[model samples]
Each structure stands twice: as structure tokens, then as C-alpha cells.
Target: MALSWDDEPTTAAPAAAAGNPEASAADVAKRVNADDKRIINAKTDVNQLVPFKYKWAWDKYLAGCANHWMPQEVNMQRDIELWKNPNGLTED
Candidate 1:
């Protein structure tokens, strides 16, 4: 596909870009205070990871790590040997 411009380009007067009133009004106090922070539409810095506002999230992460398991930690050698043996099972 090809695009063709039949009319000449024209320039219009530049307009000021609108800014968010809440974001523009943000101050250092808002960034430091976690009480005013929220999951969405927060006036504070969302990029900041330090000074955890929700302790429950951190606690849940720690608790979840306790049950972490991997296939490498399990012993499957006996199961594999039994599966490979022809006499281990009948026709069924």
C-alpha cells in the first residue's frame, strides 16, 4: 500500500499542553506520606519502592517464599526405572 498527499500541509497556532492538576500540585510531603498513597491515581510517586506503605504485601511475599518448591528437589529415579521395566506391568 502507498500513501499520497494531494493537498499541501498547513501549520496551525501552537496550543499549550494541558497538565494534570493533581500531579502538578504534588509536593514532597505527598511523596513521603504513605497514608495518602493508593494503588491507583495516587498523588505520590508510584515508582518509589522504599518505605513500604502496605506491610501486608511484604508479609505475604515472605510467607509465600516458605512453600517454594522445585522439581529438582524431588527424587523420581525409582519411578522412571519402574516405567522403563517391561515386566513391571501387564498388557493393561
Candidate 2:
């Protein structure tokens, strides 16, 4: 049977009160790995998993890596932009 969104595994809820921050990281990592496997096995497409509100943002992210664009090119562009404007603030 297919899994529903609620059936997806997740990290344990954060402690009701703050105590140990590093304590839960391992448990959280295991949960994340399991959830990732579930997603990969399902072969769900990005448009289906991502919410409509954020789909455009996801599309833009994908577009940057599409075609012949490589990680180094993307990083270089970002570095150049940063160097041009050190105070990386945009009017958003």
C-alpha cells in the first residue's frame, strides 16, 4: 500500500523543554535517512511533493542546475556577486 503524508517518518518532536541539543541529533539523522529512503523508493516527482506555494521557488532552484550549469559555475557566480556587493542585502 502507498504511504500517506502522515505515514512518513520524522524526527521525534523536540523536547517540551530545552535540555540537550546534541542528544537528539543521531536519532534525528536516523529518522531523516528512513524518510529519505521512503521518498526515493516511491519515486515521487518534485511537483507532487512540494507545496504549490513553494513550487516556483523549487523550479527556480532546478533551473540553475539544468543544461550545462555545474556546481563550480554556480558557486563562482555566487562568489562574484558576493564580492561585488559585500553586504549581500536585496530589496525583497
Candidate 3:
């Protein structure tokens, strides 16, 4: 696939958005990974942006989002108790 930075975007790129507080655009029209299905030269947040090359990671992210969990909301008392219990578990 051929991508030219000179070519306009159908939708505004994140780097071009004034509303975006933080933006990183690659100076060259090349990607950090050319093989990945990403914009030709768009500078994107690796964590925020999903890459076609790493679809499994994206799937895991989606699965995690669906659960709608917060670290504070999780109860670790059971785990602590289990760790303290000598009979239930032992250190290898």
C-alpha cells in the first residue's frame, strides 16, 4: 500500500487537532512500523492507538473495557487471606 503524507485526510488527524492537548506527529511520512496498518506518517500514542499488527492486544483491551473495572473497586481481602492461610497455599 502506498501512502503519501501530502495527501489530505478524510478525517482530521489527531496531530492536527488543536483541541488535543498533547500531539506527536512524525516529521517524515513514514510510520514507526511500516508493516503495521497505521497512517503513513501519523504520530499516534501507542497505548491509545490500536495497530492492525497487534489485534490480539486490542481484543484484550476491549475485553478489559467491557468489564468496566476499577482497581479501587476490586476486593483483595480474599487474596490476602489466602496468602496468610498456611493450608490453602504454600511458597514454592
- Among these predictions, the greatest TM-score belongs to 1
**RMSD after Cα superposition, model 1:** 19.5
The sequence of per-residue lDDT tens digits that candidate 1 reaches over residues 2-89 is 2236646667433433465554355323445453334544456665755666899778767786789787889989888888998876
The lDDT of each candidate is 0.61, 0.60, 0.65
lDDT tens readout by residue for model 2, 41-71: 3754533545536878888767764755666
lDDT of each residue in 3-59, candidate 3, tens digit only: 786867676344645564344333334455533645666566444555546889889
After superposition, the stretches of candidate 2 with alpha carbons farther than 4 Å from their true spots are: 1-17, 34-64, 67-71, 74-92
Name the candidate, 1 or 2, with the larger TM-score value: 1
lDDT of 1 at 18: 47
lDDT of 3 at 75: 91
Clashes of 3: 0
* Candidate that scores best on lDDT: 3
C-alpha-based local distance difference test score of model 1: 0.61
